[model samples]
Target: MALKILVTAKRVEDPESKIRVRPDGAGIVTEGVNYKLNPFDEIAVEEALRLKERHGGEVVVVSIGVDKSQTELRAALAMGADRAILVRHDGPLDPAVVSAMLQKIVEAEKPDLVLMGKQSIDDDQNQAGQYLAERLRWPQATFASKEASLESEAEQKKDPGVVLGADGRSLTVVREVDGGVETLVLALPAVVTTDLRLNKPRFASLPGIMKAKKKPLQELAAAALGVDLAPKVVVKRLSEPPARKGGVKVADVEELWKKLHEEAKAL
Candidate 1:
């Protein structure tokens, strides 16, 4: 049976770029920051593509952000998604708002599965996927990862961490937990969030990049979705961590202990 999978592509500041909190405590300075698809979401897309390859279906990638987020959506297309959707919304959005928006999309698309990153690097809230699953009242599996190393040859040849059951009515997922890993079997039309070790995302080839331009990329206005976009959580301010003090060399263990106890008060 063919499956239709919905994956998410989130635009985030490149981790390599320097992030600076604005002087007014408003937000980060985006003047020179480069943006890229969130790493976890990339893994999710890869898993979706793999599932499509195995089960024979379409993979649709979606992004919610400013117009520039189309860049990330196109990137997902270049990586092998059948199509893309860009939900244009420019404003502060918390997990609640994002989940609500995604719920509307999910209803419209009616995909068999919703795959996305466990968390976005920028916010690292790790709540959107869970929130979305709760709002949709669907079974959810998160922090997906395989036991083998992602770089290992065996892992490269193995099936995706998220496996579709033989009946195609359920999904089996291996997910990371607090101390180890856990497995879960979810019924169809469930939500799954990818972890770092799920899969290594493939780069877009030159031909793929050219082809992505011709792929169907539908744009939608967030307001028209009829979902309330009111933010339940708000960021009051942003601030940088305090600078670390220079380390002092200790002449002896006793001196180190004294410094730790008195100067640093670590004791």
Candidate 2:
């Protein structure tokens, strides 16, 4: 069955890059920081591509950020997305605002499925997918993964954890839960959030990268979408964790217990 899948690609600070809080505590120091596509979102894009490959269709990747976000969109295009859309906005964005913006896009695109990372690495808010689902009043399956397939490398690479119903009107999702995995059958036009074990993202080949330059990338202003960008949640400050103190060697378990109970008070 043919499908139109919409996936999100969020540009975030690369975890490997050195991150320092500004003196004023407004935000992180962006001077020399590096940026890349959010790893979870990369997995979402990979899943979308895999779904398209299994059941012939088109995959559309979208991002919301400054003009630089086009770089991430192009990266998704290079990974075999049919096209891209970018919502241009250079301001503070919270999960509420993002979900509102995505709602507008969903209304315009009307895809059969909306796929996104469970959360962005920079914020780690992990709320956008659920917020979007609620706003759209659609069924949702989050933390998608297949524990059984994950045990075998070959199986992990070959099979998709998310399975489409034979009739093509429902989805069978194997997702991670508190103690184990949980399965859910969601009707079509649902939202799904990807987890790390979903599928390994494919690297863009040289030819793919070259072709991506020529692919269609539509850019739209966030204001044009008519979704209010005012963030409901605001960050008051940013601070680094306190430095850890050097550990002291204890003579015995009794000493360790004494330190834990009296000094550390961790007991």
Q: Which predicted model would earn the best TM-score? A: 1
In TM-score terms, candidate 1 sits at 0.93
Per-residue lDDT over 162-231 for candidate 2, one digit per residue giving the tens place of the 0 to 100 score: 8889999899999998999899999989999999888788899899899999999999999999977889
Q: For residues 1-267, could you state the per-residue lDDT of candidate 1 as single tens digits?
A: 789999999999999999999999999999999999999999999999888988999999999999999999999999989999999999876888999999999999999999999999999999999999999999999999888788888557746778899999999999999999999999999999999899888899999999999999999999988888888888899999998888889999999999999998999
Candidate 2: list runs displaced more than 4 Å.
Answer: 151-157, 247-267
Per-prediction TM-score to the true structure, in the order listed = 0.93, 0.92
- Candidate 1: list runs displaced more than 4 Å: 249-267
Clashing pairs in 1: none
lDDT scores in order: 0.92, 0.91
